[model samples]
Target: MTLTKLQKKFAEGIALGMKQGQAARYAGYSEKSADTQAYNNMKNVEILAFADELIEAQKSMLKRRFSGLASIAVDKTIDILQDVDASPQARLNAAKMILDYAGMEEPKQLNVTADVNQSNPFEGLTTDELRKLIDDG
Candidate 1:
C-alpha cells in the first residue's frame, strides 16, 4: 500500500530512531540526532523503505538476543554479502552450501502445556468409525 506523506514521515522518524540507536554506540552522538538526520535525508517513500529494513533487522537482533547465542547476526549477514561471488555458478554453490548448513542445524523447540482441542467431539475418531456412528445415529 502507498503511504501518505504523514505516514511516510512517521516511518522515516522510526527508521531514524533505530539508526540513531546503533550510531550512538559507535559515534559519541545522541540517538535523537541520528533519528533527525535520517528523517531529513530521505523522502517519505525512502524513509518507509528504510523503516521496513530496520524492522526486519530489529526482529533478527531480538531473535539473536533471546536465543542467547554469542555471535553477532548482523556481522555474519555482512560477511555473507562481502564474500558473495559474482558468478552465477559460484553464488549458486554458496547458496547450496548455506542451505545445507541451515538444514543440518536443529531448530529450537518451544514448550507448551495447554491441551488445545476442546470442541471437536469426533477429533480422535477414525473416518470409518465416524461414518458408522453417524449412520447408526
Candidate 2:
C-alpha cells in the first residue's frame, strides 16, 4: 500500500529520529491534533514500512562509507610498512597490523617426530655434491 504525502513526510521524520508528535507536526498536522495524528500514523502499516525502508537505506549508506574509510586506513598502514625512514619498530608494527587485518597472524608451533630407522636422503653428502643437487633441483 502506498503512503499519502503527509504520511511519507511523517515516515521520513520518524526515520530521522523525531518523536511521533513532532513528526506529525512536521508533516503539517495541526498542533492541537498532532498527538492524535501521530498515534494514528504509528498504527499505519504503510507508513511504518516506509520508515523501515528509510532506516535500512541509511544503514547501507553508513556501511559503504565505513568500508571506504577502512580501505584508506589499510592503504596508510601499507605505506607505513614500506617507508624506509620509519623506525624498525614502527615498520614491524605496521607489518603485524596488516597481517592481523588480513587474518594471517603467526601460527602456533607444531611438533613432529622423525623415525630414526628411516634412511636419510641427504646424509653424508659432500658440500659440492649438495650444491650441485640444489642447483639441479
In the order shown, the candidates' Cα RMSDs to the true structure are 17.6, 11.1
> Candidates' lDDT values, in order?
0.57, 0.94
Worst 10 residues of 1 by lDDT: 20-29
Per-residue lDDT, model 2, residue 114, is 84
Tell me how far candidate 2 lies from the true structure as C-alpha RMSD in angstroms: 11.1
Q: In model 2, state the lDDT of residue 96.
A: 96
Q: What is the number of backbone collisions in each predicted candidate, taken in the order shown? A: 0, 0
Question: Residue-wise lDDT of candidate 1 within 1-137, one digit each (tens)?
Answer: 66544444455446556453343323333455755644453454565585688778888888877675434543454455457455666555556555555676446699979867668888899999999998999
Structural similarity to truth (TM-score) of each candidate: 0.23, 0.53
Q: Which is the leading candidate under TM-score?
A: 2
User: By summed lDDT, which 10 consecutive residues of candidate 2 come out lowest?
Assistant: 113-122
lDDT of 2 at 93: 96
CA error at residue 15 for candidate 1, angstroms: 3.8
